[model samples]
Structures are given as structure tokens and as C-alpha cells.
Target: MHPITTVHYLALSAALLLIGTVGVLTRRNIVIILMSIELILNAVNINLITFSRIWHNMDGQIFAIFVITDAVAEAAVGLGILIALFRNKETVLADEIDLLKW
Candidate 1:
């Protein structure tokens, strides 16, 4: 078998991005949306690390670590908010949430 290349990594990243975008756009469940957002972030991390490896540079790796850190923070905060919303609304459907409405 042939060795993998940057193009292969890029293709995988693109597929993940497309799936995440579609999930965020089409899903009504808040949890699924959050997962999709995570997927998108992961795709970005893959791209960053892949390029970093190819160029033998540390910048992309450092940036990927930052992205991972941010993603963890985001997931924590998002799940907390989701828990609060579920407690108050008794529903996890995104369309049914109107907590911000005045």
C-alpha cells in the first residue's frame, strides 16, 4: 500500500468539516450541536498538526494544543449551560429553547 500524504489528511479534515457543518445546521438537539462543534474543532486540530509534521515546525503543534484547550473549555461551559437549560425547560431540543427571548 502507498503511504498517506497531506492530501489524504486534508480530505479527511474536509469530510469532518462538512459533516460537522451539516450536523450543526440540521440537528435540533443541543447536545448533538455541541458534539458537532467539537468535531469541527477536531478537524481543525488535525489539519494543524498534519501541516506541522510536514513542515517540521512547532507552530502548528502549539496552535493545535491551544485549540484543544479551547475546545475543552468550550465543552465544559456548553455542557453546564445545557444542564441548566434542561433543568429549567425539561427539554434538550434547540428549537424549543427561548430563554433569551424578552
Candidate 2:
């Protein structure tokens, strides 16, 4: 059996990261931004796992696990912020929020 090439994983991760970035930059909805952030986190995990496989080391895997944990925490915190914003503004649009005004 042939060992997997690292390029495949890197390419996929890049694609996911690009999509997430585009979503973050283009989307007006706060919820979508949070989801885009999650997408970026998942792309980071893919990169870590791929490097781990290429090097035959556990360190990358360990880092991937940490990234996953961080992603979860970030999601929770981001959602909480979105909820608070929605409560105050009555909308989820990024343009609708004015933290400096309040």
C-alpha cells in the first residue's frame, strides 16, 4: 500500500479555508460568520491531521485535538455573543450591530 501524499490533504484544507474566508468576508448575517469561523477551525484540523500522517508523528494529532477543543469553545462563546447582539438589536445582520454606539 502506498503512503498517502501530503498534498491531497493540504489542497482540501486550503479549499475549505478559502470558502470559510469568503463566507466571513461576504456574509452579512452574524450567525453565518460564526459558522464560517467553525469552518476555518475544521480546516486547521485537516492540516494538522495531514501533517501528522506525513511525518508519522502524534504531535500533529495532539494539536488537532486541541484545535477541536478550541473550536468548540469558540462556537459557544460566539453564539452567546450573537444572542446578546440579537437581543439588543432585534436582528442578526452585522450592519445592524453598533457596539460603539451602545
Q: TM-score for all predictions?
A: 0.93, 0.89
- How well is each residue in 1-102 modelled by candidate 1, as lDDT tens digits? 999999999999999999999999999999999999999999999999999999999999999999999999999999999999889889999989876786
**Per-residue error at 27 for model 1, in Å?**
1.0
Model 2 segments more than 4 A misplaced: 1-4, 99-102
Candidate 1 lDDT for residue 26: 99
lDDT of each: 0.95, 0.89
Model 2 residue pairs with clashes: none
**Per-residue lDDT of 7 in model 1:** 95
> Which candidate has the highest TM-score of all?
1
lDDT (Cα, 0-100) at 52 in candidate 1: 97
Sequence-dependent TM-score of model 1: 0.93
Off by over 4 Å in 1: 99-102
